[model samples]
Target: MTDIALVRVTFDTAAEADRIARHAIGERLAACVNIDRPCTSIFRWRDVVETAEEVTATFKTTITLASALAERIAALHRYDQPVIESWPVAVDTAVAQWIDDATHA
Candidate 1:
């Protein structure tokens, strides 16, 4: 098994999600990005409660690339404060190797 970084982000549109995914993969920041189903999010921003439909994205990359991946996502995100989070994850040997290959360039 290998340790990798699992990054999760939300976008207002599928286009936005796809754009981020493409950029991450193109830049070798992430090995793969899995676009998940749309979800409803409720939060408080600027003293106002807001609700919106959001698309979730899951990114796979080496732990070493997590910071850069998050930075890239923030740069490409449209939201004033995009939701970007990552944590270390353990994966099967083959999957880990694949991630390293995909992100290490």
Candidate 2:
């Protein structure tokens, strides 16, 4: 186990994903952000199952920074409710250290 977190978010467009990624990384809220290929998402919204093409945004940051990072993302996100999830990462010793150092203000 490491003190690092991998946060994932989905956006309606590649442009929106890139905007958040750039801000998060530039502000040091995230060590890195990877925008994945577009995929289809199917889920219930307003009592109906809806499907849409979405882009996945992955963020690498420390656990300590995870909440703030999510909040910041939510603030900038356009959706009424954005999907922001974080989980602890099992990282190598050096990589964990790198995450901690890089995410520190």
Best by TM-score: 1
Q: Write the per-residue lDDT of candidate 1 for residues 76-98, one digit (tens) a residue.
A: 99999998999999899999999
Which regions of candidate 2 fall more than 4 Å away from where they truly are?
none
What's the number of clashes in each of the models?
A: 0, 0
Q: Could you tell me how far off, in angstroms, the CA of residue 59 lies in candidate 1 after the best superposition?
A: 0.4
Q: Which segments of candidate 1 are over 4 A away from where they belong? A: none
Best by lDDT: 1
Positional deviation of residue 104's Cα in model 2 after best superposition, in angstroms: 2.4
lDDT of 2 at 100: 76
Q: What does candidate 2's lDDT look like per residue over 1-105, in tens digits?
A: 566899999999999999999999888899889999999999999999999999999999988899999999999999999989999878888898887777776
